[model samples]
Target: MLDLRSLRQNPQAAKALLKIKGYDFDTLRFEELETQRKSLQSLTEELRNERNVKSKSIGKAKAAGEDIAPLVAEVGDLGERLDAVESKFHRLQEEYQAFAQSVPNLPDASVPAGSDEADNVEVDRWGALPEFNFEPKDHVDLGAGGMLDFEAATKITGSRFVVMHGAVARLHRALIQFMLDTHTSKHDYEEVYVPYIVNADSLYGTGQLPKFAEDQFRIDSDADFYLAPTAEVPVTNIYRDEILEAGRLPIKHVCHTPCFRSEAGSYGRDTRGMIRQHQFEKVELVQLVEPGRSWDALEELTDHAREILRALELPFRTVVLCGGDLGFSAAKTYDLEVWLPGQNQYREISSCSNFLDFQARRMQARYRSPETGKPELLHTLNGSALAVGRTLVAIMENYQDGDGRVHVPDVLKPYMAGLDVLDLG
Candidate 1:
């Protein structure tokens, strides 16, 4: 939510920045509401003042032993009018809040102007693509013999779900452990555990509620809780409504959790294999920093994600998301696309974004500066060090041998209990 004072000061300037995120708020309605609110609030104050004066007059009249009844009647009438004005003002305030919630956060000036992914600019590439000795198999073909069972997952949970068994399931766990260890140990992030379900306020704080609810799965029960689409929700909101000291400027957090998505409206897209699942795992990274240092943090954070790809020797490229293709909460984003030789394409394996203070403002997450002794919003950022399911896909396709076996990446060997390759039955 934008500060009310900022809205009143220069709404146009604010609106112009929001245009980069593709929002066109109704200026006339906002102006008209402000006018009414001012009038209505003034009226309420006047009625209260008049009643106070009349009450005093009535008390004095009684003390003087004359005409107190008339004064009492007049004061009672003033009370009724005050109630009416209070009701009106309350309604107007609610309307204004709804309008404010509908407005998106403004984009940073550094973001490129474009409407879609095609317009995104490539920032850099990482590692080298795997050189295969024979035809490579996609994850589905490679895992089928080892119990990466799609048919069973469908029977138990329906399509867009996969149930890995035996070594395949253990391999998935190994991938998550490897990524989490790297993020927390070498990358200097604090490990955290967060709830898988959150309230609407938490969603709104992250800019995922109201606008993107359709893409999510919401509970209709009494709790009114919604299944989180990503760890980004609970992790990013750890500091919601919090005030941190300036010295605590950049707080880093890394979390690993299973993500659930309805994948609504994604019909006929990546429907094959585990490429696009309704439930998957991910290792997430979050940072809270001073406004001046957030951009630098963005680059550093992007490198942190690329490290996982580099260690695995997986080929990947980083691209800057143009304004149109950016997430609703992000001012700018860089998606890390990992190479998959089987599909002969680079698939998005991680996404690093700098949301600036957009999310912090919504979350009311702030830090008090030591210099000014004043509190200010801290910039919040989050990125997937790697999406576990996608990383699993990348490894399988990249390491497939001619005999229908998959070689595990060296860094993942410890977690895999010294296993080198997963051979088919």
Candidate 2:
């Protein structure tokens, strides 16, 4: 949520910045609400003052042995007027809050301007695409030797689901373990375990509710729990409504979780395989840092995610998301796209973002400022160190042999029990 004071102080400036994000911001609605709020507040103050004066007059008149019926009646009328004005003021305040929450974060000035992914600027590329003796197969076709089972997944659940068996299943678990281990042991992030289901407040704290509710899978029971879309929701909410000491300026956490998404708006895209699963696993990294250092933290976090791709020896590139491509709570974002021989293209495997203070403000996650001795919002950042399922896809597609076997990446051999090649026996 944006600071209402900032919008009130200079709405034109705010609107201009917001325009970069492709918002057709409504200035007139905001101005009209502000005008009504100020008017009602002024009226409420005047009425309260009149009531106080009338009460004092009544006391004076009683002491002097004069009738005070007219004074009492005047005070009662003022009280009613004050109540009406206050009621209207509260309503307008709520409206303003809804308006602010509905608006997405302003894009950073450094972000490139564009309407969609086509406009995103690539930053760097790594590794080299694999050479194949025969036509390369997609993960679906490559995992067809009883290793990846989509038919069973569909019957047990529905479309956009898959069940991995044998070495492929082992590979899936290995990917999660490898990612968590690397992030915790080498990336300086604390490992954390969080609930897979979360309440609405937790979702709202992370800017997921009200705006993206349709994209979530909510439980029907009274708990009103929703399956987490990403570990970012629960992990980041750990500091919601908290005030941290200055010394703990930066907190880093890495978590692995099963993410569930409705994929509500997407249809007929990437439906052939696990590329757009309703359920997927991810290793998520989150950081909360002091305001001034968040931009630097963004770079470090992006590099940490890139390290995983490098470790897997996957051909990939990093791109800065344009204004239209930015996430709801992110001021800026970098998407890591890994080369997929099957698709013959690069697909997103991770997204690292600097939300600045956008999410902190929503979460009420703050730290006491040493300079001002007051609580100030902290900056929050999160990224998929790598999406486990997609990494699995990349490995199978990139490491396939002409004999229809997949060789495990060197880094994952130990996790795969030292069996280098996944040959269907």
Candidate 3:
């Protein structure tokens, strides 16, 4: 959630910044609501003060040996008025909160001005795109012979799903392990195991609720549980409604979990393979740091994600997302697009974002500032160290030989128990 004080103090500046992200700040509506809220608040306070004054007068009348009936009746009336105004004030506050929650975070000043991914700026590229003498096939075609079974998955669950068998399945698992190990050991992130299911509050804390409800796989239970959309959600929410000491300023966690998405908006895109799936594993990296160091933390975190791609020997490029391409909660974002021989283009393998205090404010996650001796919101950052399925897809497409065998990346060989090649023969 945005700081209401800042928005109230400078709605015009906020409106201009939000416009870059494709959000039109409803200043008129906000003003109307704010006006009413202020009026109701003022009335509520006045009534409470009047009631307190009148109630005290009733005691004075009683002590003076005079009939206190009139004063008692006046106090009762004031109490009734105060109750009505307070109730309205409470309701207006809720309305204001709803409006506030719908607004997206303002993009950072450093973020480039653009409307979409086409305008995103590429900052760096790594490795060489694999060259294949034979015509490279997409993951769907490469994993055809019972290795990547979409048909069986369709029969069991539906579209946008896949079941990997034999070596392909092992490769998928190995990618997860490799990513988790890399992030935990080399990147200094603590490994965490979080629930695959979460509540509505958890979703809201991560800026996925209220706006992207349709994109979630919500459970039918009365408890309002939803399938984890990404490990980022559960992992970052570990400090929801918490405060930490200055010494614990930077908290980093790496989590591996199965992510579920309804893909409600992305109906037809990437429907052919594991590129888009209802169920896919991911190795997610999350960090909580003091406010001043967040920008540096973002660079460090993006490098940590890039390390995984580097270790796997995958060619990839890093692009800074433009203002309009930024995620709902992120002030800035860097998307890592890995090269795929089959697709003949780079596809996004991970997104590293600095949410600043946007998510921390929403989660009420804070830390005491050593300098001020006061609690302040922490800056939260998270990234897909690598999306496991996409990494698997990249490996298969890049490592395929003329004979149709998939050579495992050197980094994952130990995780695969010395298995160097994947042959469905």
Instruction: TM-score for candidate 3, please give it.
Output: 0.96
Cα lDDT of model 2 by residue, 1-425, tens digit = 88878878888887887777888779899899778878877887887788778788899999999988877875665677778888888888888778889988878999999878988999999998999879998988887887888999989999989998888889989999999999888988999999999999999988998899999999999888999999999999999999999898689999999999999989878888889999999999999999999999999999999999999999999999988888878899999999999999999999999998989999999999999999999999999989999999999999989788989999999898878999853
Error of 3 at 275 (Å): 0.6
Q: How well does candidate 1 score on lDDT at residue 43?
A: 88
Runs in model 3 deviating more than 4 A are 52-70
TM-score of each: 0.91, 0.93, 0.96
How big is the positional error of residue 233 in model 2, measured in Å on the Cα after superposition?
A: 0.6
* Full-model lDDT, candidate 3: 0.90
Error of 3 at 259 (Å): 0.6
The global Cα lDDT (0 to 1) of model 2 is 0.91
Greater TM-score among 1 and 2 belongs to 2
Q: Pick the candidate with the highest TM-score.
A: 3
Taking every candidate in turn, the Cα RMSD to the unseen true structure, in Å, is: 2.8, 2.8, 1.9
Model 1 Cα lDDT, one tens digit per residue, 1-425: 66667788888887777676667767788889889989988888888888888888888889999977777766666767788889989999898778877776667787777778888888888776777667777788877785688999899989999988777777889999999999888999999999998889889889888778987889888987998888889988889999999887689999999898899999799999888899999999999998889999999999999999999889999998877787877878899999988789888888988888878888999999887888899988889989999998888788777787778899999999878888755
Weakest ten-residue segment in model 1 by summed lDDT: 71-80
lDDT of 1: 0.85
